[model samples]
Target chain A: MKQNLFSPITESMYYILLSLSEPLHGYGIIKKVEEMSQGRLKLAPGTLYGALTNLENNKLIISVGVDPENIRRKLYKITDSGVDLIQIEIKRLEELLRNGKKVYYD
Target chain B: MISQHKLFFAWNEDKEMDYLQKMARKGYIFHHTNFFNYYFEEKEPESINYAADFKGFDKMPEEEYLQLFEDAGWTMVCRYGAWYYFKNMDMDALLYNDYHSVQNKYKKLLLFLLIVGLPLYYQLFIFLPRMSNEALTGFLFGFRLFVYFIVILHFSATLKIFKLYLKFSKNIHE
Candidate 1:
């Protein structure tokens, strides 16, 4: 179930990439990850920026632009590679759930 | 303006004590004024007197005073290093711990892999004869792939840790 190419990228990386599918600034990404994770993950500012930088370096995401009102902040959006990876991850997870349900129920 | 502050630890009247007093007096005369304040170690002093005319001293061509202080039997405990300006007067221990912990974690991981993985690989390939040469070759290839995978993971993790450290240090400075 976890055999997909994107499974090597960590759950944190997957979630972070998912968060940036829409353009998001640093804080916005953190809040989205937390909310989406159901508070299971609370990303510190350091962790969030680290993940963002890594994703950008890997070309999985690209910085869109800085908000005109807050130049210190930068916004980012997922790239084609990122969207592809997320799709792979979703398929992998779905497979895992399917196998688990079959094993448990049938 | 250059200012001087004197810290007195004890009230002994020995030659060492006398020497310190002489040095202090000379320092004052050389600068041509009593532009200094004395602080007793035991008491909380009011109004630290920072010498106003000490500006040029910071820009002094050489650190002559440092040698002079050493010659006067004063131990130079601390001096400015690379991060001297960014260092906090308090929370030094916390910052030091953070730096050392990150360094030690990397060191330990490297050490563990070297100590454990090398012998295990040697035993698997060289000692185990029942494992066919083709099987051994495949195992070695798989091992190399595993190592490559681990290298990528470690590289990513290291980048993340470094970014976290940079963010923390920058926050502290701000």
Candidate 2:
């Protein structure tokens, strides 16, 4: 299987990609990521905006809709590629934990 | 209302931000900043968080851009195209959480500056020299020099912005 270049996503990118599983506006992603991470990963607006642009450009996410209250608030949702990338990342992390646990118990 | 005006140096956002914060500490709140002038109005002093993001190269819609910052609790003070100014009451609030995105902001500014410089660069070689003639050339020698000076200034800004972009990019992790 050909590996995706973005398989080893950073923790921030992981949360952001995961957050995009549901349709969310820019602010919604920030709020959702913070909530999901239990305030452990707070995204600043500017950073989150940049990442969203990059992710969209890479075809991992798509602008799905706009907010009713604000014309400028575009909502984003992850694509199948993004979901696949995150799945690979999760398995990578799981394997890492398995290896570390094996070593610790030995 | 008396508005303080000053031209800040290119690539020196820290000094510019410091000046704004100092003004805020002394009862002045910044209202607008174009490329060359910063306009401020006096107000009651309080501890405030100030930040700026260069968004001219943004691929997203403008409404989406500002709303994100608003959601993050930053109040937009003023904007001039690419330059966005914001303030927050929280001391820890920042415009960027990651160094990569911070670099992206500067890179966008650099791209805009480069675009601004290109026409000036082209004009320096294309149109300005074409205006020179014997009698007119001698009479407008000083005018030509002044135009050249402005073009050079544009080039300098372009260079400084590129330098800032590289400075931010160097520390950014993949």
Candidate 3:
């Protein structure tokens, strides 16, 4: 029921939605998130699983496929809506950076 | 040797886990769990990591469900019921990073209480009015006491979980 997708995106949600731009399963997303963040983002199974549920519920992501060996490891990909979220989030963060720069750099 | 201990679902879950962890440190690696007993086998006293999570069905082929964790270097130790216990093979073995997902576990527990508790409440309501005689009244009074105790326990527990969820939401990373 969180319809306002980009109102407040947490760091974990940001990475998770970004990771799903391409199809990735549960463990795949975990590994990718760590690699994507240069070992900074350490995602837990419970958090990842719950985020996945919420993301799907909000229609930001969709199940694309499943791991061949393990059917439970369903692959996920960002939807068109999710793409819009990424763009909006990027702009919002850019504004924050610009405002910080004006005070600190000036 | 196997040791028996009581288990309470709502409040004592963390304590139950800690008790097992301490036993593991003392060279008593936890073997399996029953309703009231946690069996442990002797082993060398060394640091071992353990984590637990609650998950549900559509988790077909339990081997593969576990293999995903195994691939991530978390060896599945046991799956007694909904609780899946694992031991870390490496440092990146945290089962949960944020309290939001941890809240999901309590939600499931609350659902279970509603399912089991509602019917009992209904049955007691029907039985209470019929006990008019002194002997029956005494029996009903004692039984009602037991029922009321459980109602208080469950109510307090549910409220506690809701408060925890709210607290977690405040400073939460997700």
Candidate 4:
């Protein structure tokens, strides 16, 4: 996989992928994203749908099945490629934080 | 039984209505009429004879619908030439008209200021410094007052543009 291809993912996209480690339908993903961000970010339906479409198109995520309780619903899960991308993003963010701390404090 | 499916489009006006009709014939139903159009589908009600239902005819193509209207001796005018024109006329037209007016109003206001205001301000700024000693003294003393008028005009123009955006957004939400 191209390492640079993972760099195009935004912070929100990273967190959204993280939230979908387990299967999640639309509202569940929204709730998880909010919880992960501690309510700092709220994803509107339009923005969430747009991100979902892009992620699915990139093969970073896949629709698993409909929620059993709600037949109208859909559930999605992260692909193996998405998990690898997430690991890369975490390492990149750690390096950024380390550099930022050194420059700001020193 | 109801079946829900995802809808996708790339903003093409030509193929939009045919796509909507195809979706509708396959039992899809539009849920919302505003900014984001949402669609779903369900089976016909058992008590209702599907052949006698006028509501199902709502899903028919515009040309066919217009022909039905014409057969009934009503005249129809085609505007926008898309799915939106047939379904939600009052709301869609009001939103479009408001957006158009706001856009036109801002264009005219900006043109007026660019063509007239900037040159007029520049002339006054330059000429006020070159007047007779007495007039020059007076103009220098009143420079703040002149600046104040310019500031007010700038503020008014900014407010008008802001108001237009607010109205445009409000119409979309409604």
Please give the ranking of all candidate structures by TM-score, highest first, separated by commas. 2, 3, 4, 1
Model 2 lDDT, residue B91, Cα: 79
Clash pairs, model 2 backbone = A72-B64
- lDDT for each residue of candidate 2 in A27-83, tens digit (9 for 90 to 100): 888889999999988999888888888899999999887888876788889999998
Error of 3 at B112 (Å): 4.2
Give model 1's docking category: incorrect
Off by over 4 Å in 4: B1-174
Pick by TM-score: 2 or 4, better one? 2
As a whole number from 0 to 100, the lDDT of residue A62 in candidate 1 is: 93
lDDT tens digits, residues A1-106, model 1? 3244445565667778889878977667667987999987655332343455567777899978876766545678999988888888788778878999999988
lDDT of 1 by residue, B1-174 (tens): 234464321112133234333443344321222223422232222221111101111211223323222222222323222101111112111211233223333343344445545655565557454544665466676765665565565455445545544554443310
Under CAPRI classification, how is model 4 graded?
Answer: incorrect
Stretches > 4 Å off in candidate 1? A1-6, B1-174
What overall lDDT goes with each candidate model? 0.47, 0.81, 0.73, 0.52
Candidate 3 lDDT over residue span A1-106, tens digit each: 2345455677888899999888998789889999999998888866776677778878899987788876767788999999888888878879888999999997
When 2 and 4 are scored with lDDT, the better candidate is 2
Residue-wise lDDT of candidate 4 within B53-143, one digit each (tens)?
A: 0111122234433433332222332232122233322211111112433343344444544555665566456755565366535656577
